[model samples]
Target: MADASNFIWYELMTGDPAGAARFYGAVVGWTIADTGEQTAGGVDYRMIGRSDGGNAGGVLALNAEMIAGGARPIWIGYLHVADVDAAVEAIKADGGAVQMPAMDIPVGRIAMVTDPQGAPFYVMDPIPPEGGGESDVFSVTEAQRVRWNELATSDPEAAIAFYKKHFGWGQEGEMDMSPLGAYRFLQRGEVMIGAVMPLMEGYPVPVWNFYIGVDDIDRARDAVTANGGTITSEPMEIPGGEYAMNAIDPQGAPVGFVGPRK
Candidate 1:
């Protein structure tokens, strides 16, 4: 069922929104649109966007209140769920914490969740897109496995269970990743979604990194650093020698880009 609907919108919320807009414009090829803030619970929100001319996502101002409440800066993925209320309850029952209670958005309903650990992911039952990726019972999902989400969780077993109960996601298998660490690719039937790793061991808070597929790895690596992104792990040759690298976007969200090794 995984399709464009499962992950239609993504947002990068950073302290410096202007610098972020410019950096991403160069990296992901997305245009930005700044619409003045609209108040929510007395909070002013500045709107940022790709405006359909670039990629399909936006940039939002980080919530100081949440940060003060022990929230860290990160790029959050809001997956589309069929029923928000039922899904939230199921999550709590399965040991996942509902960091932010379910709230209504103009687009649909959204709720933030932590997988036993504190890494937060957003879930929204979209209003349905006119076309593109949408999850179904038998449809092959993630039209572009080009970009996927990665969750650095404490327990791979429990993580798999939690998602299986909530969204029917399953672990396809573990492929050797060598020096970087073990890689257990995840999927929802045929739809390629994300990866599970041990990056945030024992922190009580998990780290979820997004991966962007580029036609050329070297060019993407250059694009990242050129746009002010930090390369935590430079592109290295995998054992059999394929090319891949890790970097943090201007907002400090870790993402990876991969392609054939030269």
Candidate 2:
């Protein structure tokens, strides 16, 4: 079984799925395939498949109802839990709002939620694989895969408290950005999956940003700009001799990319 608080899935909710497919394919070298699957509400969903034959994430088209209700293109992560109902209850008790009630799906039960500072994400109890094989969904060390998750929120300390209450995350380490305060790294067990920090001034509500891995940061950054995506930040080096950038895809969904310069 996977760890209680590990992020097991990533998804994109976009206004234009086809446009997103083309842009991400160029930027991240992904092959977007039609899963021929629908949500419990019957909306069309697409799959983001990695080159290594492992599934990376999912994409679903925003429908009329969602658009009318002010839905926009965005990427969200799904945190796996052992029990959907209990997780939802704990989330509410810890100052989170349930955007979607717990419900059954083909693969698992899921509930959409927002933390106290309003960072939205999914909590799911996935159905175990048949014949007992592990699902290789995430790989921080693999190129062309989701390598990191980040939460830029209004209050990192309070957000950490709420998450710890429900998901059992602990503060593993932190980086001091004097002007911006601290970048706190969070871990579920031994694996360092992501970090949380204060949302920069003038940014909208709290949101999670996922970093997809690439073989070469420079090449991928160029691909992003060449493919109609806007590079919000130029490539910058991190602790592991890797570089990363933040960007907004053509459809306006924000995403990040990480890897080396070569």
Candidate 3:
């Protein structure tokens, strides 16, 4: 219960759930935690999480209603923030839309928002920060959170404005990428929390993709498909010789795990 780095929880909203559970088990080294029911957004939800009996995150049975006006499937990240209300106010003042207003949950107040470019994500005051909802709060290990925060949007200028206003997350440095204005990395203080990049032509929607850390990429990729998951990208090397793969769970929710290179 130290940092947001562990990404303590994860959730999938998918079309084929049973298959997703099986796929994730293979791709991710996790076992089944629990499956339960809930009613929200006009559809029922199936809770999915880390097999380690931890709050890895959850999965929901997606329906036409859940998608925007019945749009395609999307995965949203929930980041733990220190203060929910202040965060919400900053997001609003910075031109971001609050899709779901702040509401108190068993853990603490949670709010759903679209960064200036419309990438959907939720911000919450975790139980530990709010007191005993999860584990006690401590600036513990700089645990490696597989799903680190990053946003992809058509309008990154506005996007940066939104986060800086809300969470005080501002640009760290920009790396020149020829045609694509430099790629911008963001920071929460000195910690690398997320990034912002221009949306590619024809690939329109602005969204956030979660990144998971693993020890092996090729093996993780095979495990994903073998376990019933679908691979969107094959094992590839990222900078520094690190390798990774991207895929969609059996439920069609985008997922990726990163590992050290050979």
Off by over 4 Å in 2: 1-3, 34-36
Q: Tens digit of lDDT per residue, candidate 2, span 201-220?
A: 53588999989988899999
Q: Residue-wise lDDT of candidate 3 within 1-262, one digit each (tens)?
A: 1233222344566765666667666666554434546544344455544444544556666666666555455566776777778878877776678888998765567888877777887878776643345431111221123535556788888778666655566587877767877678877566665578887653368888777765567777778777767777778776667776768776556766777754
- Candidate 3, residue 241: CA error in Å? 2.8
lDDT agreement of model 2 with the native: 0.86
* Clashes (N, CA, C under 3 Å) per candidate: 7, 0, 11
**CA lDDT for candidate 3:** 0.64
Model 1 worst lDDT window (10 residues): 136-145
Local distance difference test values of all predictions, in order: 0.64, 0.86, 0.64
Error of 3 at 240 (Å): 3.4
Candidate 3 RMSD to the real structure: 4.5
lDDT of candidate 1 over 132-243, digit per residue (tens): 5552211122111236667787676677667666666777778665664678878866667667876542234576776554446676677888988988787876433456
Best by TM-score, which number?
2
